[model samples]
Target: MQKPGADFEDELENSEGAEELYERMSFTVDKGQEPLRIDKFLINRIEGGTRNKLQQAIEKGHVLVNGKAIKSNHKIKPGDEVLVYSETSPESTEIVPEKMELNFVYEDDDIIVINKPAGMVVHPGSGNYNGTVVNGIAWHLQQQSPELTEVALPRFGLVHRIDKNTSGLLVLAKNEKASIGLAAQFAAHTAHRRYIALVWGDFEDSEGTISGHVGRHQRFRKIMDVYPEGDHGKDAVTHYTVLEKFGYVSLVECRLETGRTHQIRVHMKHIGHPLFNDDTYGGDRIVKGTVFTKYKQFVDNCFAICPRHALHAKTLGFIHPTTKKEMFFNSELPEDIQQVIEKWRRYVSAKGIMTEG
Candidate 1:
């Protein structure tokens, strides 16, 4: 495992930090191995492991059978590849655990899916240490077990992350093996991720792709910029489909081919439609709406409804490390996003504006 290095600290100085991956360990299930239950198979194999503990691990998706997460009773067949993995904290930083109300979408011993709300930072960075998703995860795990004596990430792990204000699904590995598996999927662009964003302008084409080189903005180093015709920065691609268009602002669903920092926001802005209310990318101002007082007030109200950027990590899908089975999860649009979208619909209706793509 490589240290995050200076680049990571620089990015976190401004964005509050969420990018993290974990170290893992793996094993293969041989034919000569135990043919009984997965827990029974792992029993006495893992250091300091007991029957109940192994059973808990299997039940929590720790012990994988042939690559998929299975229950405790799952019988390992011949030639099955069994892998066990989890994570501990990096030696560079000490993460402090804090109690928080986090929405757990799915959990097994291996990984956890969290519905991260807007305004929550995912990691402990320079200025911020406690009250982050990582902190909460540590506390949550400690509640489940009494042996979490380490102040660092003993069992806590992070595979992927979204922006601080980007609400929706995020996956975290509970151990080393799970983190490594999930990280590989994301790195290879095999993990299925879909986001819903409201942009400031209408699209000429209903569905299209945005490709560019994304990196720190030359002028505004705190934000992101795009290079259209060169190979100066990291390659980034975003595929978008127009879901609805309300004269000025439009609702879009964006699928990412590469997980770059501020990729969607930068790409959208590069194409002339910044995400609505994204303060970092010059989206707070009225960019597309009419200048009338009523229209201005309406837009302002919509902004107030969803104080953050109008983006949500709506769906996530990935191949399970142990089972290799396709696992997918979806989240509803948060109340703020949902309500603002409805407001736009009603505003367009009352104004008698029918926008044709």
Candidate 2:
């Protein structure tokens, strides 16, 4: 309801970033500082920031306790270290929707499925506005039904999102009933979503499950971490099987039980097999000369063409909200990813290694 982040506005006016103005304070709770909420901890530590600003920081996830972001009322235990970023004061600007092209896969009265391409951001925020998936969807919806007013623009009711760089099948609800139905399926873990990823190692088993509580990474807030079993994090389940083995690389399909942000990438990385070409989760530094060496330049060039995580929503299954019929949809790997897999296969074949089956 309030502006995205008051600190964002503060940053624009101050000219200097939050790092320059705000001093990051770290404190280990002693007997006197026993238990306190995250916001209360910030109020006591940070000097210039107001309570309102503190709340904004908490919401934006800039403030962390014990390496985890917490709500304003989150109770902090002893030994918890709190980190707060400096304030930002940027001016508010009108968000004008720009025209963009959308590849429509399926559309009906209540829902639409799109094969969102890599490099297309899902929404408008953080130095990106035009040319996003949302903008494109908005444009398409407007053109599809001109009788609908600007206020009537459904923007293709976003039910869930794949990362900006991950290309795959994404469904958008056309109305509220469909949106609620699909969202509930995701919440209940009934919608079967599967992804295909080329990771950097040969897993031990033909199939296995990785389950853990998923929370934000301790140092890099953008990345998710597989936390020790606990309450603050939600249970994430990933079932993976190897379709083919390429010595140092393996093509695998992963299915999720809980749809947390970066669930597959985080879980795979936790088990020592980060996605191929993934930089944040440790796929970028994979030994290039191994399988993908001959086409290193080509692969690098392709990565630049679509600088996204090398994961795709290969298959999706759910019951139709209106028809009540079980439905499933799948997309082949994108050209860039397909090439990576092909090259790896060639390398493995050259070495006389057969498919894993």
lDDT score for candidate 1 against the true structure:
0.77
| Model 2 agreement with the true structure over 93-126: per-residue lDDT tens digits | 4334467667788888877888888877665555
Across residues 1-357, which tens digit of lDDT does each residue of candidate 1 receive?
Answer: 223454553644323432324223455667676568777767757777688877765665555666677887788877887776542223335666678899999998888899999998877655555678888888888888868775434334676778889999999878766766786576557788999999998888999999998777676666778986575667778899998888888999999887777889989999999999999888998999658998789888988999999999999999987677899999999999999988988888888877544
Taken over the whole model, the C-alpha lDDT of each candidate is 0.77, 0.68
The TM-score, computed over Cα atoms with residue i paired to residue i, of candidate 2 is 0.69
Q: Tell how far residue 307 is off in model 1, in angstroms.
A: 0.9
User: What lDDT is reached at residue 84 by model 2?
Assistant: 62
Q: What are the runs in model 1 whose C-alpha is more than 4 Å off?
A: 1-92, 151-156, 355-357
Backbone clashes (count) for model 1: 16
TM per prediction: 0.76, 0.69
